[model samples]
Target: METSLRYTSNSRSLKIHAKEKLLVNSRTRLQLHGELDTGTGAPSYFCAMIRYFNPEALTILGLGLHYNKREKLRCLVRGKMEFPVRTGVPVTFNVKGRCDFDQEFNQRNPKGAAEFAWSVMNFQEDQSVRLKVGYEIFEKVPYMQIRENNWTLNANMKGRWNLRYDL
Candidate 1:
């Protein structure tokens, strides 16, 4: 378990965060975290995430809840999750979107936060090089209720060699 509250000169926000992790079994773990941020035009977030890994499963399963304190900008409750497998080859899938809640936690507003996204990555490593390729798109709704106007679609490919041994 860990908890912290701090300020950064590079960003104009005061943040408080806490996280806890417990081992349930040899191949399962649960992580819980919450964060409060007091910044202009930003939403505080609370997230609880869990992941499971097994050789027979041949992949890792992850899921979590992402809560937002600001109702005027984003969905009050969003879900964040991902799946990745690397036993033989490396691949990953990711997603995030609004939950069943629309308004803030208070239920005063009847609008669900309008956002969704899906992404995938393929990664390869060799004795001398590492490469990764991925793409993602964020689905947005402009119904005058989201009010945040956060939307983007992106893709990238990269190759790099490790350079940290100071040779």
Candidate 2:
């Protein structure tokens, strides 16, 4: 179990944040987090979030929910899967998405990304360093056009090579 609180103030805004997390199992965790911001000229709002993380089979799953007066509500989901190869290492595929809830199912704001990566070395809990390379795409759709009660997704997709180091 873990808990924390933070408070910060600037010339224009003051912010407060708190978080609590509990380990449900060896590889599973549940958390609750919240934040509040208020000040002069800044729109005051409070946001709360809940998250869960765990490993299932050859995949890692993550789920979350965010709520606030500004955005109303949002949901997030992510999955990472590993496939064994002949080289004795595994290649990983990851996909993640976060979207705002709208009364109309076809019209929504969505942000999504995906990656395919493989580590240079076998990952281990005691290992201090690792490198990974992957190709990734990030897409965002802020507005959907409603035509004749049907909606279409308007998004821009950007793709790039991603190199990451973990220590």
Count of backbone collisions in candidate 2:
0
The sequence of per-residue lDDT tens digits that candidate 2 reaches over residues 1-167 is 12222222222334444566666776666766665454433333333334444444466666666566666655645555554444555555555555555434444566555544444432344332222333334343222211111111221223222111111
Model 1 lDDT per residue over 1-167, tens place: 67665454444566666778888889777877766666753436666666666556345555554566554332333343445644344444434444333444444223222222222232233222222233323322321111111221222222211111110
Model 1's lDDT to the true fold?
0.44
Pick the TM-score winner: 2
C-alpha RMSD (angstroms) for model 2: 12.1
- If candidate 1 were superposed on the true structure by all CA atoms, what would the RMSD be? 11.6
Clashing pairs in 2: none
Span of 10 residues, lowest total lDDT, candidate 1: 143-152
Candidate 2 residues lying further than 4 Å off, grouped into runs, are 1-20, 25-28, 34-56, 84-87, 98-107, 118-167
Lowest summed lDDT window (length 10), candidate 2: 144-153
